[model samples]
Target: MTIRVADELLMFLPAARRGPVSRVPSDGTSTLGHLVESLGVPLPEAGPMTLGGEPADPSTRPDPGAEVRVASVPRPQPVPLEPGQVAPRFVLDVHLGTLARRMRLLGLDTAYHNDMDDPALVVQANEERRVLLTQDRGLLRRRALWFGAYVRGSRPDDQLRDVLDRFAPVLRPWTRCTACNGELVPVDKQEIERDLEAGTRRSYDVYGRCADCGQVYWRGAHGGHLEKIVHEATRQVEAAGVAK
Candidate 1:
């Protein structure tokens, strides 16, 4: 059987196997999903697929010599949800600490631990109904994962953009604590004055405190840069919503 993966997905394949088309030696019973994964593309990152020019799913077993075409996941991809869930929540692998903080800065619910093992991460995701985001292809292939996505970039900024482009979660800037993924609540300046430095007291009046960890936040020198990121993410999400 022959499989033709979309250009966007070709990066996942071995250099020798990458091209417009590929030949698969199917035993005539393997499902399309298994075949595609064997080629190194995770199912979550794969978009629409067709077998023999007709629509097909991962479970569809292709006959020998059949042609299968796999596309990359579309922008603003819909996140699968369980009942009662209002929005997509995410849990990240250890290496994604910076991305996790950035997501929190945008007020997205993100859970991350630098020391958690793969099993623990999967458990947290399933128990909390969060989509697992990781750069490790092997982690995404774990059978126990409820939902998973392969993070595409090596740099934090590029990785953040890739995530926003793929799943346009609502951006609520400054509403979450970047340090703890806690909700931020407005607090009187005087209430946290003791925690603030002398310059902070004089420079700004607005303040927010993390409800979970007591971390204080204000429009510090880095606020402008953070604001830029939020603005760009907001625009990206709005555009994605409109595209839908």
Candidate 2:
């Protein structure tokens, strides 16, 4: 049998097959879904398929000499989230601490606790309906997980870009606490006055606090730095064509 992949979905195809449609040895009876996974693309990542130019589901077995075409998941994907997750919320395993922090910087609802075990992470994902974001393919292979993605990049920047490209979560800057996965709300100066140092009290009037942790925040000297990152992340997500 022969295989062809859409340009956007090519990355999921095997390396040599990634550049163009290529011929493949086929089992006379295996389902198209099995063939897709055998070639390295996960079932969830696989989209519509066609055999011999006719519409087909991933479950359909191809006929002999059938030229199959595979497409990527349709964007904006259907991912679960917490009630207010304008973009999908996330649950990261221990390895993604840096990425989690970076996501929180963009005001995304990302849950990352270094102490969580694999079982706990899976349970949390199911209970909270948050997408599991991990580099481990084994975890992504779990059938109980309703939503997830395999992070292919080793660097934090590339990981972030991959996430932005794949999920297209809406950017909500300064709306979440980077220290904790908590929502941020404006707090009047006098309300959190007891928590502030004299320098903080005198230097900044605008204040915000984490609804869950009660951690205080203000637009202090680092505001510009935070703004810069927010702008950069927003630009990247936009360039990825997923920003709403």
Candidate 3:
């Protein structure tokens, strides 16, 4: 009923050390996944598992005094698809509001709201088949979540880069509203003439309108700033992902 987590995984433990942990039942039977979870390290934190040095999955049940080991994973594994389940999407926690906007800017369908509570966030992630993205380790441990990732970066650019490298979601820039997560559709400049500010009208011609929020978008001087961010983020993620 004892378990030894990998050194890399020790961060997930309160003690942060490899050791014998868990309370064994009188019958001496405890599943590896359950034992790992009992130690405050979620199953997702363990990469490869083994019983007596042989390869095993999370479901393997070990007898008392059986040696169980867990390794660290680069990222959480995708949840196995179930019948009637929708395609997986990304769900950002409240703290990642800026990263949410960045992901939306890249045309990824990201779901986020700064005011959402933990319970509601978990529900949305589970019910919608979304991959919960957060820096909170406890939130990522929620058993209800089918797929989740721990954000390792502090800044928006670093976080966005980590996400892009992890899930490798399709990147389609300028198709979503940065202010609101709405799809941007092409609009004739004349169609939104009245909506445009005087400066915008005089400086830009092409336009896009949010189908949901009715916000107008045009490539203005600020477009260069956005392009630089996107270009830098893409380069960082891609460069880091290349095998050395």
Best by lDDT: 1
Residue 140, model 3: Cα distance from true site in angstroms: 2.0
> What's the ranking of the predictions by TM-score, best on top?
1, 3, 2
The alpha-carbon deviation from the true structure for residue 241 of candidate 1, after best TM-score superposition, in angstroms, is: 1.9
C-alpha root-mean-square deviation, each candidate = 1.3, 3.2, 3.7
- The deviation in Å at residue 22 for candidate 3 is 11
Each model's lDDT: 0.92, 0.81, 0.76
Per-candidate TM vs. native?
Answer: 0.96, 0.80, 0.82
Best by TM-score: 1
lDDT of 1 by residue, 44-90 (tens): 88899999999998999899999999999887778877687656899
Candidate order (lDDT): 1, 2, 3
- Pitting candidate 1 against candidate 2, the one with the higher TM-score is 1
Q: Native-vs-model 2 lDDT?
A: 0.81
Which candidate, 1 or 2, would have the higher lDDT against the true structure? Answer: 1
Which 10 consecutive residues of model 3 have the lowest summed lDDT?
18-27
Q: Where does candidate 1 clash, by residue pair?
A: none
lDDT of 3 by residue, 163-209 (tens): 77666554678988887789999999988898778988998888899
